[model samples]
Target chain A: MAKVAIVGSGFIGRAWAISFARAGHDVRMWDQSRAATGGARDYISGVLDDLASNDLLRGQTVDAVLDRITVVAELEEALAEAVHIQENTPENLDVKREVFSLIDALAGPQAVIASSTSALLPSKFTDHLEGRHRCLVVHPINPPYLIPAAEVVPAPWTSTETVERTSAFLVDAGHAPLVMQRELDGFIMNRLQGALLEEAFRLVADGYASVEDVDIGIRDGLALRWSFMGPFETIDLNAPGGVRDYVERYQTIYSNIFPQMLRRVDWAGEVMTTVEADRRKRLPKASLGDRQVWRDRRLMALAAHKKKSDREFGK
Target chain B: MAKVAIVGSGFIGRAWAISFARAGHDVRMWDQSRAATGGARDYISGVLDDLASNDLLRGQTVDAVLDRITVVAELEEALAEAVHIQENTPENLDVKREVFSLIDALAGPQAVIASSTSALLPSKFTDHLEGRHRCLVVHPINPPYLIPAAEVVPAPWTSTETVERTSAFLVDAGHAPLVMQRELDGFIMNRLQGALLEEAFRLVADGYASVEDVDIGIRDGLALRWSFMGPFETIDLNAPGGVRDYVERYQTIYSNIFPQMLRRVDWAGEVMTTVEADRRKRLPKASLGDRQVWRDRRLMALAAHKKKSDREFGK
Candidate 1:
């Protein structure tokens, strides 16, 4: 069994701890402030209870998984014996660079250092480190215990072995990694997401559709298929002949709309007011925390449903 | 309680017949060729059996729902007393215009005429009709009986009353209509879909990621929440404060990437080979039909799961 170290004990770090520990790894969590790591363990304890109730702890008891994660007093102690070191400090590039430098120097030479930064590329932070070859980005959708897709992005200077090792490690920890050929700005998920968001914002701003209507298009429509299949597979099955046939038949429709879609809609511009108003009307700001709990519960139920469905229907 | 006329008996028309009849509407299906209409019943019969087996026929027997849909010999007979007329003729502009002209002249003034054309705009076909104000587009993703979301797009000439009635009628028929204010080229679903597809194609074309990896990003990652909540609700709940807070914190990242996303990769170009090869490797061309069946079954199971989850979790 390999040891996993979490350098920053925020939400992302705590989430990584749950996934690593639940996967039967020994996890060590540490943060700059001692209170943060302590709070992370407490947060994880409550989450483990929720996960256990939802049958998501992989047949292990909550205490068993919780017992596998230890909050360490120092960053060096956390990284000392770890084969994999996950850096989840603040999103700022300078903060990440500084933290990665310390993790690189203190962690074992065999350790693969990974960042959970969704926004910053790996090169910006790790290029200055002495052991930069071992560093890559293992960005996750928040709360990795539930969401499994992570992006394994390597810097230009980073070794291919690091990418393979990180990808394999994520898979072992129950993640589906989108291993990149090289680094790009938004990676895969965000680019796809950003593409959709730009159109959604434009749809509302252009007075063609309402915020609710656009939501209905996805929530009730396109997303249903996307939950189980990707866009490529979706189009593959859409046409009789396959993906090529699908493009041949439908590419023109998208090509015509491509010019209109090129115009970027500023998410924080005038449309934000309408979007915020609609969201606030539907879900009052006061109950955001309660709704967050509800969202997590829904995700758990979906994950459980998917587990059963995958077994019955063939994964 | 109402008579609904389906002016074509293709797959979409048959699917619409099942949904409308299951909701207790007396559905009359007619097509230019009698054999096609005959085949539609045969197809719907098989689908109804599947729906019944999955407990998806809305607590009604397959025979009960099938009995409400009748194949009419003539268009005039079907349109005579119908409250709503759904035209599903060939998608060619000339064919739609000619068929719609005939439908307009024969149908009663009270009947709301809706086209199932996903390609052409409502105005393109309905402009010259005497009853143009009563006409609009009611586009559905195929097999609308299972997928409840449909785009109710209105032409410039379409009245507010027409939009309201169509939206209400769809809701009554167990559909979530994206009630669009004005008709655009791709409508809501396709526009959003097109945006994502463009980025997906670009990713493959630019050699940044593989087809399988991109698919995993959605099938496993982003689409989980999208199946229940939408983009607006997703970001609203993502941040601490709300949608505006999410925008304030994260919009810059998207805005920065938006420029890179503006360049459209020709989907029919080199990328088609890679995408098609990837898809074909997963499922050969011979198994496309079987995969389609699997997709439909998956959709049925997901729909059933969503129904229960929505009730238990509070929609």
Candidate 2:
């Protein structure tokens, strides 16, 4: 089992802690604020309980996994005896730089120092670190316990050995790690996401469809196949031949339409207001937490579906 | 039950005929070629048998449902008592225009004339038709029997009444129709698809990752949630507050990376060769048909999963 040190006991940090611990890792977490530490403890326990309730926790006992997680008050204590240090501090570059420097100083040379920065590139924080060779970005999708895909984004300066080792470590820990060859903002997930949002925003801004309808367009349409296969695989199966046939048939039209869709990102302020109003109409702010649970339940159901489908048909 | 006329007896046209037939529609299919009519008969029967095997055919008997579909040789005979005409001719503007003119002259005033054209704008085909008010693009995702998403793209001249009626008809026909307020090249599905492909191509072209890894990045990652909920709805449930909070947290980086990732599309020979090599290594051309069946079976399992999950959680 890997010994993981998760710094910053916030939502993401706590999530990472639970994910590792649930995967049978010896995890230690630390936070700057004592209050946040307590909250993290409560949150992690609650998350574990939820996992147990869903029968998703595979450990001998939830207590066994919970016992493996040690919440430390000191960052050095958390980093000590760890094979990998996952820094989940605030997204501020200065905070990241400071924390990364401390981690580099405290961690052993072989230890991988990974950051859970959703948007920030590793270079922004790891560039000045003395042990920068061991550092890379390991951005996880939200609710990492359920979603196991991690984007292992390495900076231009990050060593190849570090990237390879981190990828192997993550895979060993039951996470699917995708290595980014070059560091670009948003990584892979957010680039695809931004492209989608740009068009969704444009559609809403132009009064073509409501927020609800746009959501349906994805949940009920393209995203259904996308959930099982990526764009290339989707195209490959789309035509009789394969990707080449698909491209031959559709690429000309898609290429023709690409320019018009590439518009300025207007964020659709007015449309957002309308959407907010509609969202409020459908689901009140007071019930947002309940709705969030509904969303998680749905995600769990989706995850369960993927597991079942993959097993049955090798999807 | 809706009385629908399916024009043309190609693969897509046959699929549409089965869809309507399965939905308990009095479906009359018209084809100029006798060979095409015979092909449709065999295809429809095979699809019904498959549906029966899967326990998806809701009708009393597969034969009864098949009995409802009549193969008529003349357009006038097909549109004689039809309430809605679904034109599924080859994707050519001239052919569409010719069919639209013929259908408009023959069909009654109340009959909603819809084209299953994936790429053509309704305006190009319906501008000269007398029943242009009732004419619009009702483009379906392939194999609509399994994936029931139709983009109801209306031309600027298409009546709001027509759009609403078409939407209602599609919903009644057990299809999810997303109404596009105006015509855009590629419509909604393909545009979203194009955006994804652009990124996938760029990723492969730039040598950031392997084709298989890129496919895993989506299938195992973003598309998981996307299949059940859209990016906006996913983010809405992601953070504490919802989309606004999500944007505040991740937008800075997404905005930062958007420009850098927006590379020009290079559909050059070498890029295709590289992608093909990568894909062929994973999935050979000889086994494409077998893989397609695998894809369909997976889709079936996925559909079953969605049904169960949605029902259990009321999502």
Candidate 3:
């Protein structure tokens, strides 16, 4: 097992701790505020209980996996023997720059420093670091213990070895690493999700469909197949001759729709009123935390279902 | 039980027969080409066995569900006492228009004529029918028995009663109807799907990511959450508050990336080579038919899983 460090022991950092420690990595979590670091183990312990109940703790008891994660008080100790350091600092450029500079100075020469910043591109912060070649973004979907897909984005100066090693590390930890060639705005998942969200907003803003109708189109339709297979594989198996044949039949339709999709509705603009209204109508604003918990539970059940199916149905 | 007529006995028509019959509807299927209609019962019988094995026959023997569907030789026989006539002739406008015209004439005044055409708009085919007020589009994501989302799109001249009846009819068949306000190209599912696909193609074309990497982003990442929830509900439960809070925090990130996304990739042009090569590398041309059957089996397993989870999880 590798030695891993989670620099910011908030949500994402602690979540990473569970993932790494479950994968048999010794994880050290640290935060600037002692209060955040102090509560890290408790928060992780609570989630570990849920994971154990869901049988998602990799066949280990809650304490067995939880034992590998330690809440360290000092940054130097956290970075002492780290092989992969995942930075989850606040999403400000200046803060990330300062944090990376500090980590670069303190981290071992062989250690790889990865960021969990979804908002900033890697080049923006890693450009000033001496170990920039070994630095990249290993952005994960929240609660990485449950969701396995993490986008590994590299800067222009980031070395190929770093990308390869990070991908191998994630795969070893039971995560699917989307190794991107170069850093782009929004990376892969958000770029894809942004496209769908933009269209969803336009459909509602233009009065063609309600937010709920658009939501049903996914929550019931395409997502059912998408949950197990990618879009490429979905379309690949759609037509008789696979992807090319399916494209030959249906790609023109998307091409025709592309022109109509050239327009965009600002997510926070007028569409927010309708989107928020529909959401609040379904789920009151006060119950968001409970619903979030419910979503995580649903995710856990889905994760368990996938694991079982993968064994039964040859993933 | 309602009387339903499937005017084309192809893949979609037969799938709809399974859906309607399993819902205890009396389904009659007819096709213009006798050769096509000849195998309708046999094809459906084969699929019903798979459905039976998966326990998707609504707690009935395969023969009980199969008994509800009958293959008729004449169009008049299919449309005789039908309350909902689904025309799935072909995607060609002329074929749909001619077939719709014939069905509208033969259909009873109280019956609703619904086209399963994914390509043609309802107005384009239903405009000249005398009973156009009772006509609309009820496009099903193929194998409506397995996937429940169907878009109930109405022509401009279509009455509210038609849309409501279509949606209610679909709901009775256990469908989550995306009842749209009016006819639009691509409808709801395609509009949402098209947007994500455009970004997918753009990602590959721009050298930011490979086709497989883009697929991993969805198959392993967003789609896991999406299998149970929609984009709105996803973002709703993501932040501390709700959709508004998510928008307050993350909408700016998407808005910043929107300008860069004001671009398009030619699906049939250069990108086809990369996409097809990537897909063909994973799956050969000869295995597509087997894979399509595999996809249906996976869909069946997923359908069963969803049913069980919905019962246990209160969805």
Candidate 4:
């Protein structure tokens, strides 16, 4: 087990703590807010207990895993015995730079420093760090305890050793790591999400379908196949000649619609108003908290299902 | 049980036979090739046995379900008793026109004539039919026995009664029906798929990442959440204020990338060559058949997992 430091005690940081501790890592977590760090251990304990109840816990026991995580009040204390420091402060470059500088100075030179910045590129803050070569982005999907996808993005200056080590570590922790060969804005997930949202926005805005109906198209139709197989693998198995045959048959029509799909639809105008109204009807503001609980339960159930499935049918 | 006629004995038609028969429908199937219809019953029995073994069989027993299906040599005999005629001929407009005309003439006026045309709109062939009001598209994802999402598309001439009945029938058959408010090219599934494919193509074309890496990004990342909740519901549950808040935060960024995303990337050129080459290396042409079998098995396992999940979680 690696000695891992989690330098934030908020939602994502707490989640990382659970993931690392459950993976048997000796984890230390620190937040700028003393109260945040103080409460994080209890919060994570509850999460681990929930995961155990669902048969989704990764460790031997909840207490055994919780025993591995230490909630520290000071950043230096968190970094003292760490081989890896996961920086998960606010998504501000200024905050990130300051945090990395302190982490670089306090931690051992061999220690890997990673950030959980979803939007900002690592170069924006890590370029000036003495240990910049070890800094990269390990952006997790929200509620990483349930979803295991970690987008490991490397800055140009980040060493190949760092990328390989981070990916190896993530895989060891049972997280699926998608390491970027080159830096691109939004990485892959958000870019794909952006593309899908654009068309979903257009479909609703153009009055072709309701937002609810558009979503049904995905959850019921495309997502069932997509949940296990990727898009390319999907098309690869779609045709007799595999991916090449699929492209040959559908390329003309997709290209034809490319021009029309390019047309701008205002995401913030009538579309937002109309969709928001519909969403409000479906889920009232008063029920958001209850709905969030329901969503988490469903996610846990899905995670458990996928785990069993992967075991039965090799991942 | 409703009398259902499956008007083809190809892969999709045979699969539909299994779906309807297993759903306790008195199913009659016809194919232009007598040879095609002759071998269908044995093939269906094999599939039924597989479903039974997986605990995914819908009816009382394999023999009981198989007893409900009849492989008819003549189209008239098949349509004579069909309350619902599911046309699954070749995806040619000409073939669809001819089949629908025959089905319209032979079937009772109250009988619903639904085409399983994945690409062609219902209007393309149903416009000139005497019973055009009763004709619509019930486009299922391939091998609909496993994936139950059926796009219930209607031509302008199609009546509300037709849409409602088709959706009800699909629900009874254990398929999720996505009823469109109005018809559009490719409908929702293909449109969303096209949008996703376009972005995936561009990512490869631009060298942002490899095709394998892109596929990994999806199966590992976005697909996990998407399998259960859709994009809209996901965003809804994501923010504190729900969908509106999510739009407020991310709309500007998505809008900014709209133009860049709009740029057409040729799907048939060097990109396809590169992706197809990589895909072939991963699974050779000789192994494609075995891989497809593996994919089908995985799909079955996923379907079983989803069925239990939905019962527990309530989709």
Candidate 5:
């Protein structure tokens, strides 16, 4: 098992601890706050138990997996002998830069320092570091315990060895590692999501469809295929002649609708509020916590099903 | 049980027959080619059995469901005593217009003449019909027995009564129905899909990512939530304060990337070929037919899981 350090014991940090531990890596977790670090073990244990209840526990037993993670009070102790360090601090650039600076000094010479920032580019925080060549963004989906795809993005000066080694490390940890060609705003997942959300907001703002209708259109329609296949794969299987045939038949139509997609919607305006109001009507503020639990459970079930199906059918 | 006529017994029409029949509707099917209509019953039986194998069959037995569909040689006979006539002809406008004209004359006045055209607007085909008020587009995902979301788009002149009745008919047939706000090009499903495709193509073309990496990004990352929840609800629950909060944080980032999404990609160009080549590497051309079967089975399993999960946790 590899030695890994998870810096910042917040929700994502704790999740990274579980992911590494469950993959049989010895995970050392550290947080700036002593109270958060002290609570990390129990929090990780509770979440692991919840996953076990859903038949989503990664390893033999919760205790066996829990035994692999050590919650260290000091950042230096956490990074002392680590092969890789996963930094999950706040989204602010200043915080990330400070944390990475500390990690770069404390981490071993060969250790890969990976940031879990969803929005910020790796270069924003890692460019000035001594070990910047080994530093890259390894963005995971929220609650990485359920979703395993991690986007591995490298800065301009980041070495090819860093990308390859990090990719291998993620795969070894049972995560699907997707290495980006270069750093772009929001990366692939959010960019695709952003495109759809832009149109969705525009559709609502333009008074074309309700928020509920928009959700229904996806969950009930396109998502059925999308859950298993990507957009390219979906269109590939759409026509007899496959992707090219699909494009020839429908490119003009999509082009016509592309300009109609809203470039900018006032986030604080009626459009956002209308969608929020519609969402609240379905799920109120009081039940957000419960809905989150429900979402996690459903995610566990889906992951389990996907795992079984992939085994049955070659991925 | 409602009496439904499935005109043009192709893959979609036959699948519709099973959807309605399994839900206890008496289905009459017809195709212009007698040879096509002749083998439809057996073809449908095989698919129904496949769904049964996956524990996705709606009714008591395969034979019991199969007993409800009858393949008729004559179009007039098929349209006789029908409440809903689902037309699944070629995507060609002339073919649709000609077929709908025949169906409009032959079918009863109360029947909802719904076309299963994926990309065509309903007005293009049904505007001149005497029963145009009773006609609209009810586009189904292929193999509707497995994926039940049908895109219900109405022509400008179509009646509200037609929309309500058709929606009821679809739900009764155990399908989730999404009604479009108006007759837009490509409708809701394709428009959402097209937006994603545009971004995906541009990403690959611009060297932001490979074809495979883009697909992996969705199937592994976003599709997990999207399978059950739509984009709006996903972003709603993403942050504690809901969608407005998410937008307030990330709106500018998404807006920055929106213009980069390619407006048009030539179908016959290098981009399409490269994507197709990548897809072909993963799945060769010869294996496409078998892959289609595998896809259908996967859909069935997902449908079964979704049915049970939605029941356990209220949708």
Candidate 6:
């Protein structure tokens, strides 16, 4: 197991620590705030307890897994023995640049430094670094312990060897890493998310459907196919012959409706109010924690389902 | 249980017959072609056999369930004792118009007329009908036996009472029915599908990732959250506070990328070629049927998992 350094003791950083440690890596976590570091330890313990209860952990003892994570205040000590450094500081560009500079100064020559920034382009953050060749972005879905996909995005300056090594390391740490051939805004998952949200916002703005109904369109409708297979595979399976047949049959209708999707919404204004009001009606603000728990449980059930069925389903 | 009549004994029509019959409804299927009706009976029997192997049915006997489904050649005979009519003809506009006209002429006043057309506007087909108030589009995901979600979309002229009755009937039939507030092209499911396909095409076209990686981004990433909760509920429960907090944190990023989705593609060309080539690489044309069966088995297992764990962990 590699020694992994996790900078910043925020929610995402702590998640990365626990995920690495649970996968049997020796994880060193660092944060400027002592309180943040202390909170992360408690959070990690709680998460490990949750995983143990669910029988999702590979280790025999939660203590054994927790013992592998060392919460440190010194950045130099955190990066001293690490093979890869995962930076999860605030998403501010200036903050990221400062952190990456510090990381390059303290990290060993062979260590690969990666960020958990969701939107910031890696080139902007790592361009001034002396060890720019060894830096990239490894974006994980929230609660990376359960959801194992990571978008391994590289800047133009980032070496191919670094990308390959990072991919191998992430795979070894029990993550499915998708390599981004070029850096783009939102990467892969969020780009698809953006598209859905655009249409969802447009639908709500037009009063075509309530926020709840739009959600049902996905959760109950298209997402079922998506959970198992992707959109291309879905359309391929939908038509008898293959993609060609699917296009032949549905292309006309798709073309007819394609123009409607080009209609964009200002997601920042009245649309937000509409969605917020609708969502609040379904899930009250007071029950946010309960709803989050509900979301996690659903994710667990879904993960369990995918584990049992996806291979058989050819998804 | 309602006595359901399935008009047009194509693949979807026969599947509806078996689904309603499996749920213990008496089903009478009518096809213009005698050979098609015979084929539907055999197909329904085969599907029932598969369901029996999986312990999905708890009937007196497969023969008893099969006994409930009678194949009739005449439209009047099929609608004789039927309480609900499920029409699944070809996707031609004139064919839909003719079928609706015939159904309006033959079906009882109290019987609900629903079309299985994925693309046609319900108003266009049923506008000329005497029983137009009783008709609406009840679009099911393909192979409705495995996927239980049905979109009950009503046109501008569709009555509220009709929509409510259809929703209630579908619920009783063990299906999740989401009502569209108004008519729109592609309704809700396919529009969301269109949104996803647009971005997927853009990603592949821009060379951000391989077709395979984009598939993984969905099946392994966002789809995990979506299979259990709608996107609204997903974003609602994602952050610590709820949807409001999630938006506060990620809205800027989402807003930044939302414009990128506005860029449209002519999906009629090279994009199709790229996706087709990618699909053939993974699953050849010859292996599609076996793979589809694999998809069903996976869906069954996934559904079973959701059934089991949702009670325990789904909150």
DockQ for every model comes to 0.88, 0.61, 0.81, 0.66, 0.68, 0.69
The segments of candidate 6 whose C-alpha lies over 4 angstroms from its true place after superposition are A310-315, B52-64
lDDT of 3 by residue, A210-240 (tens): 9889778887999988888888888888777
Q: Is candidate 1 or candidate 2 better by DockQ?
A: 1
Task: Kindly list the per-residue Cα lDDT of model 4 for residues B1-315, writing each as its tens digit.
Answer: 989999999999999989988888999999999988888999989988888888888637899999999988788888886789898999899999988888898898769999998878888998888889999999888888888888888899999999999989988988888888878887877888889888888888888777877787778778877877788888888888888788787776676666678577778887888898888888898888887877787888878877887788677
Model 1 stretches with alpha carbons more than 4 Å out: none
Clashing residue pairs in candidate 1 (N, C-alpha, C atoms within 3 angstroms):
none
Using Cα atoms with residue i matched to residue i, what is each candidate's TM-score against the true structure?
A: 0.98, 0.94, 0.98, 0.96, 0.97, 0.95
Candidate 3, overall lDDT? 0.88
lDDT of 3 at A302: 88
Residue-level lDDT of model 3, residues B1-315, one tens digit each, is 889999988899999999999989999999988999888888888988988898888789988998999999899999998999988887899888898889988988879999898878899988898999999999999889899999998999999988899899899989999998988999999888888988888888888888889888897899988888888889888888778778889887788888877788777778889989988887788877777767777778888888887887767
Model 4 global lDDT (CA atoms, 0 to 1): 0.85
Candidate 2 matches the true fold with a TM-score of 0.94
lDDT of 3 at A1: 74
- Per-candidate interface C-alpha RMSD? 0.8, 1.7, 1.1, 1.5, 1.6, 1.6
Better of 2 and 6 by TM-score: 6
Give each model's clash number.
Answer: 0, 0, 0, 0, 0, 0
* First chain of candidate 1, TM-score: 0.98
Error of 3 at A157 (Å): 1.4
Predicted complex 6: CAPRI docking category: medium
Runs of candidate 2 with Cα error greater than 4 angstroms are A39-42, A49-55, A58-61, B39-42, B49-55, B58-64, B261-263
TM-score of chain A of 4: 0.97
